[model samples]
Target: MSKDYYKVLGVEKTATADEIKRAFLKLAHQYHPDKNGGKDDKFKEINEAYQVLGNAEKRKQFDQFGANFNGAGGFGGGQGYGGFGGFQNGGMNINMDDLGDLGEMFGGLGDIFGFGSARGGQGRRREPQRGSDIEAAMTIDFLEAVFGAEKEVTLKKKITCAHCGGTGAEPGAKIEECPTCKGHGRVRRVQQTILGSIQTEASCPSCGGEGKIASKKCSECNGAGTAYDTAKFKVRIPAGVDDGGRIRIPGYGEAGDRGAGVGDLYLNIRVRPSDKFARDEYDILTKKEISFTQAALGDKIEIETVHGKVELKIPEGTQSGTVFKLKNKGVPHTSGRNIGDHLIEVVVKTPKNLNKRQKESLKELGI
Candidate 1:
C-alpha cells in the first residue's frame, strides 16, 4: 500500500500550503544527513511526502488516486502523474527542454528522493547556492601567531568544469530524451512483502535520473560536470587565534557544480611548538636565565617579546624565580583595539665549571 503523505508530514489533508511547508522544513532540518547520523532514509521520506503534498496539482492527483492511478503508465510502464514524469519497466527518460522549468519542482522532489538538483536555465543555470563551510588545521610560528600573519595554502578539490560550462556536454550539442526512463527519469519496482506488494520509485540509472542524455560529452570534464582542480588560498591568521581556535574565511572552499555559488572555508589553527616562548589567550610567557651573581648584584638583561627585544632591569637581591611583566607586548585582541602583555620568568643559573684562580679567589674571600 502507498504510504499516507499527510501522515508522513504530520499534517491534515486539508492543511494549508504554508502549513505543509513548515512541517516539511522542520522534519527536514531534523533528519538532514549531515546532522542526523546517516538518517538519509528519513530525510528522503520527508522530502517525498512534501513533494506530493506541497504542490496543488500533485496533491489533488494523489488524493484522488491514492497510488492507484500511478500516472500515465500504471505501476511499471507509464509516465508519472502531475509532473512525476518518468517511470518505465527498464528505466525513465527525461527531456532537456523540461530541465529548465523543473528546478523548484525537482529540488523539492530531491528532498523527497534523497538527492539535490541545480537551479537555472541552460547557459545561465547557476544559482546562488550557499557555499559549504569548511574546516582545516593550520600551524604557525608562536611569535607569528601572537603578532598575526597571512598564510597561503593549497587545496585540492572538485570544482565546476570550465570546458562544458558544467553541463557535461559539448557546446552546441543537442540533448535527447532518455530511452530508459522514457522522459520520466524514474522507475517503479514492486516487491512482495508480508502485507502483499509494495511499490517503490527510484532514479533511472542510465541517464543518472535527469531523464535526458547528451549526444556529445564534454572532452574536458569527461561528462562528469565537474573536475578536480588545485587552488591556492590566502588565509589570515588573527593574533588571538590560539590552538584549537577556528577562523572563518568566506567563500574560499570548493566551488559548487554548474555555476552554483562557492562554499566557505574554515581554518582550525594549531600553534607550533616554540623553543623560547609559550602562550596563553593573549599573553606570551618566556623563561629568562640570569647568573647567580647577576641576580644578587642586579643587572640589565635583554628579553624577547612578540614585538622585538626589550631591556628588563632586575632589582638588587632579586629572587631566582621572579616574574616581570612587559606591557602591550603580547597578542593583539580580536577587537583590534588593544594588545595583551608579555610575562618574563627569571631563573638563576649556577656556574657548572670554576677555574683555579676563581676558586682561589672565592676561598680567600670566604675562608
Candidate 2:
C-alpha cells in the first residue's frame, strides 16, 4: 500500500515546496533519534516522505501515480523510479544548496549522513572564498551618538605581503604545476559506502587550490603570503544609534586567500551616558530642579536641551514630578525624516533651613 507522505508530514496535497519543507523540519526535530525520547522509526518515515515530496520531479511522479509509484516496484515497471539505484551504482547525490544551514538540525548525525555544512564540502575547492569577519568595539559620547560623528579606528591584522604580493613566492622563483591534482586544482577519490563507490573531489592540499607551487618561498613573509600590519579605518556613526548597536564596514575585514572576496568589519557601538540627559529610544529625558515658590508662582525658566537652551514655563500648583515636553529638541533621526522630543521632569526643592524672620513670616501667612 502506498503511504500518504502528505498525511505523514501533516500537510495538504496542495502544500508548496516551502510548506513541505517547514513540516518536515518540525517533525524531524521532534522525532530525531538523538533526542531523549526520539522515535527512530518515525524519524525514518518523515525522512522518506521528505525525500519524495521535497524534490520537484519526485513529487510530480508521486502526485500522479501515488507514493508507491517510486517504490522498489515503481509504476508498472517504468525503470522503478531509480530511487536508490543511483546510490547503488555511483553514489547518493545530496544537494547542499537546498539544505542551507538547516543541516545543523541533524547535529551528531552530520558525519553519518555526509551533510554539507555552512563550509560546504571539505575537499572541494572554495572558488572565491569569503574572507573572515572581524569584530571591534567603539565608544562614543552621548552627544556624538545623538548627533553623529566620524572617527578612525586602528587595528593590527594580517595583510598581503608586499614582497611576494600575496603569492608566497620569491621574486624570481620557478612556479611548477601542482603534482597532486595535475594542475586541475582538485583531486578526486572514490570511497566505498553502503550506497556504492562514491566519488568526491577536494582542493589540492599541496597547492592550496592554486594549481601551482613556488620552488622558493618568499623571504620577507616566510612563505605565509601575508604579514602583520596596521590598518586604520574611518567609520561613520549614525545619529540616534543606541548602545550595543552594530555598524558594518563592508570589505574592511580580513583579506581573503589569493584575492578572494573580502569580508566585513563589524563595529559594536558603546554609547557613554550623559550627565544631564537620559535617552529612551528617540526621546531625550532630563530633570530640572525648581524652587517650591516657582512651582506655586508659575515662572519661566531656561532648560538645556540637545539642540540648545530653551525656556520652559512652570505652571501654577505643579507637582513635584511634573513633566514637560519640548517639541523637536531631542535627537534627529538617522533617516533624517523626523526628530524626537525632549522631556523635562520637574523636581521641586523645599526650603529646609529657615531663619527666625522667614519662619515667623511663613507662620503669619499660615495663620
Please report the candidate that would top TM-score against the real structure.
Answer: 2
Candidate 1 lDDT by residue in tens digits, 1-367: 4678788899988899878877876676667666636377777667667656777877887889885644322333243452433211222222322322342443442333222322222342232244455677888877667778899988877677888877778888789997766878765555442212335555554565677878887888766567788878687887677888888887787665544567788888888878877887888898989997899889999998878899999988888789999999888987789888999999999766899998888779782
RMSD of each: 10.7, 5.3
lDDT of 2 at 2: 72
Candidates' C-alpha lDDT: 0.68, 0.75
Report lDDT (Cα) of residue 8, candidate 1.
83
Q: How do the residues 110-179 of candidate 2 rate in per-residue lDDT, one tens digit apiece?
A: 4433433223446543343456889998999999999999999898766677898877688899999877
User: Number of clashing pairs, model 2?
Assistant: 2
Q: How far is candidate 1 from the true structure (C-alpha RMSD, Å)?
A: 10.7
Error of 1 at 224 (Å): 4.7
